[model samples]
Target: MGWFLGLGIAGLVVLALSLVFDGVLEGVGGGLDGLLSLPVIAGFVSALGFTGALATGAAGAGAVLATLAGIAAGTLAGWATWSFSRALLRDGAPAPRGEDLTGTSGAVVTAIPAGGYGEVLLHLAGQPVKYAAKAAAPVARGAEVWVESVLSPTSVTVRPVER
Candidate 1:
């Protein structure tokens, strides 16, 4: 009982921490997966061996308390892993940030069709750029392409290229 309770408390603390660490506003998936590790957390706590001893310490009142705490801790760890994986790893094609067409590889989303309006995919940069690009041919939105030429501040011209 006591063991389960204590373990439970630990679990809840860890779970809550994981949630706050990888909240939605943080941008679903980029590189934050390294924070929470269930095995690491649980194994570390279990190593103390206090939980086991507490649960089975005396086979009397002590046993009941210890069992409770151990269960609590285990539950918390499970919850943490579940929450972190869901919030941080949402799957979606990463889109370009700004008009930064520098050193990136993306396909023309809106075919330049002409010049005033063409789309190119550059590896999304930290800061997104706001510019238009031109391409020789129509750069299909999903076409595999790269930034060929950067015209101006918010303007870039791109063409197809091999990966």
Candidate 2:
């Protein structure tokens, strides 16, 4: 009973530290898989063991049986929690669409000769993205431009801005 309690307390301390520190257990495993993780597994086993032992009056064989049962239950619960969290946090956001560039203002990164490809930088999702660009007329580097159309996933057609 004392051992189980001590183990549980230690495991909880480790778990708390791991939460505060990003790389507390990076070498232990590549990622946290809940109960499969060392700290989580230890915490589950100790918590369950102590509770089971206490409920069984801390007796001999009954205490052992209860501890084993607790470990099993904790493991299942931990696994379920981990899986649910992973699913809930899954990145379901779609990638930026090419059509999103239509009418957006940008600047030429490379000079675009008439009917030829160069490069233009546009702000999309708050970040600069360079795209292959072609202009109806020659556009020099640093010239202001606007996306006229999306030619492909990685290319676009632009027109020089009047200003």
Candidate 3:
């Protein structure tokens, strides 16, 4: 095969490897994100490889530059792929309630101080979701609490969250 053709194949292989590792298209709201991710990454990565090959030719160092360029391109591709995969396989996406933390159930990890301080762990999507918890009634460690609402970035108000 011609140099350009071989280069094209190598570039594609790099891109695929990157996508398998990087995760550029994860959780893209599942619509346009799912459809357009591939073509976009492919076009961008191909352009990069083509440019690298051109640079290699101009420098009269085609063989060396081509190998290194393929490696670099593969690296970029891998990063994108990993990122996309992560988005697609998000572990515990925030409950679609937009932080409206009402009636969440968790077990208190520490005694809840009335003034505002504590910790709790609960299951959100089969994952251990821990949040700072506090309540009007003092809660002992291991006590069940209902997350009445989210009070701050790391905290939630609580009551009894009956099983």
Q: In angstroms, how far off is 118's CA in candidate 3? A: 1.4
Question: What is the TM-score ranking, best to worst?
Answer: 2, 3, 1
- Estimated TM-score for each candidate: 0.36, 0.54, 0.45
Give the top-scoring candidate (lDDT): 2
Q: Which one is best on TM-score?
A: 2
Model 3 ranges off by over 4 Å: 2-5, 16-98, 114-116, 122-129
Worst 10 residues of 2 by lDDT: 30-39
Per-residue CA lDDT of model 2 for 52-145, tens digit only, reads 6565664554656867766776676556655665677587987788899999999999999998999999988779999999988999999999
The sequence of per-residue lDDT tens digits that candidate 1 reaches over residues 1-163 is 4454465466556546655554542344357543335433543355323454555654544555655665565456546655666666676658654444655666566666854576454554454443467777766667776675677756676766756
Candidate 1 Cα outliers beyond 4 Å, as residue runs = 1-103, 113-115, 125-131, 136-144, 151-154, 160-163
lDDT of candidate 3 over 85-162, digit per residue (tens): 657768765664416556667788877877678889866555777788778877888998877777776777888654
Which regions of candidate 2 deviate over 4 angstroms? Answer: 1-80, 124-127
